[model samples]
Target: MLTMNDLKIDTVIVLDGEPFVVQTTQHVQMGRGGAILRTKLKNLISGNVLEKTFKSGDKIELAELSRTKANFLYKEGVNFHFMDNQSFEQFILSQDQIGEISNYVKDESDVEILNFKERPLAVNLPPKVDLKVTSAPPGVRGNTARGNVTKPAVLETGHTVQVPLFVEVGDLVRINTETGEYVERA
Candidate 1:
């Protein structure tokens, strides 16, 4: 069993037989008293979010979760496909579950898929990914009058990031998937 102290962002807990991932948590104490936890959680099954409060020292059960290595195959219609590395079995998830995570990955990328009770719950993206700029406007030459400047650039995966003005179309850039920010030129 886990307690309020074990709660943290991304922690999964079981409540009323439903699995919820903690989205946010704040701890507060009324002087000389026990603390309370305020948390925002998202249901892993139905994709709903709600705020929950827990008293200090409260015990909660942890959900049974699993992760497996998978390779993104491709998206067909509204479904995204993956193939397990060990079992070679295929899995498909809809856009609803995939959500904004689609922005961080492209075809053939390796990823970890989190599952609950044999169902895919979420996708864990890598820390960094290399992407090629598909469209980048030309930087004004002799426009060195400005300090560091960035221009919008679209990646091959269809995600856009602001790149240094010197970046050009076809340039390969590294991006931090977690932050969706440009890290450096690859």
Candidate 2:
């Protein structure tokens, strides 16, 4: 059990039998009223945002969440398959559950699966991933009239990212998964 004081960003708590990740927290107190804690929570399973308020004496239940190392095998239709590193068991998760993280995932990559009560709920991707550039348009001469020149390059994973004009096909580039931006040539 957690009290209002325990509420903080990224803390997972249970409300109405659902697990929610705390996104933001604010504390407010009136002249003669008790302290109130307000929070913006994001549902781990449904990708929903909710605003909730709790009094000073309110108790919050911390969610029992776990992370397991997994190797991404492949994607079949809308399902993404993964093999648990420790248990050697395979599981599948739908595209809707993966959200934008799916764009950064590649076959045979390692990821962490977030589990609640032994059930997989979401995937945690590394902050950076290295991918090969499959296609990039030629950089035209004198294109630097706009200060810095950039071109869209298609990666092996089929994700497009803006890269410097110097980047070309067959180049391995590091990308920031959280921002979906090109980091540098690996």
Candidate 3:
């Protein structure tokens, strides 16, 4: 059990029989009333978001969450597979559970999988990923003066991201996985 005062971003807690991950949390104190906690939470299994407020002393159930580093193996249709580095055991996850992280993950890439009561709920990718540009328009030499214009580029993994205009096919670039934005030329 945990109290609202102890809530932190990324903490997993059970509410109304559903596991929710804390997305954002803030402590608030009313001028004439007691303290409260304002939080934005995301449902682990359903991907639904909710805004909630709790009194500072309110008690909440702490979810049974486990995290492990795993190597992504492959994807078969709607299921993505991963191998646990420690146990060498493999687990398969549904696309909905992985959410947007699936878009930036490459085969055999290292990732952290979060499980709630032994059920996979989320996938965490590294902050930055290096990928090759599979397709991009040829860069015009005089385009440099335009100050960092961007063009859509397809990656080897089939993810499309906006890259600087100077980028071209076969060029390697670093991408911010969280935002799916181009970070820099690699």
Candidate 2 regions off by >4 Å?
Answer: none
Q: Write the per-residue lDDT of candidate 1 for residues 1-186, one digit (tens) a residue.
A: 998999989889998888899999999886988899999999987889999989886898899999998999999987899999989999898776778778877899899999988778788887888889999889886565776488899998888898888899999899997788999999
User: What are the per-residue Cα lDDT tens digits for candidate 3 across 10-115?
Assistant: 8889999889989999898899989999999999888899999989778999998789899999989989999989889998888878877788888888999888
Q: Model 2 TM-score?
A: 0.89
How would you encode candidate 2's per-residue C-alpha lDDT over 1-186 as one tens digit per residue? 999998999899998898999999999996798999989999887878999999998989999999999999999998999999999899999887788889889999999999988989899998998999999999887898978699999998888999999999999999998899999999
Worst 10 residues of 1 by lDDT: 140-149
Error of 2 at 117 (Å): 0.8
Winner on lDDT (2 vs 3): 2
Local error of candidate 3 at residue 144 (angstroms): 3.1
What TM-score quantifies how close candidate 1 is to the native fold? 0.89
Q: If ranked by TM-score, best first, what sequence of candidates would result?
A: 2, 1, 3
C-alpha TM-score for every candidate: 0.89, 0.89, 0.82
In candidate 3, clashing pairs total 0
Error of 1 at 51 (Å): 1.1
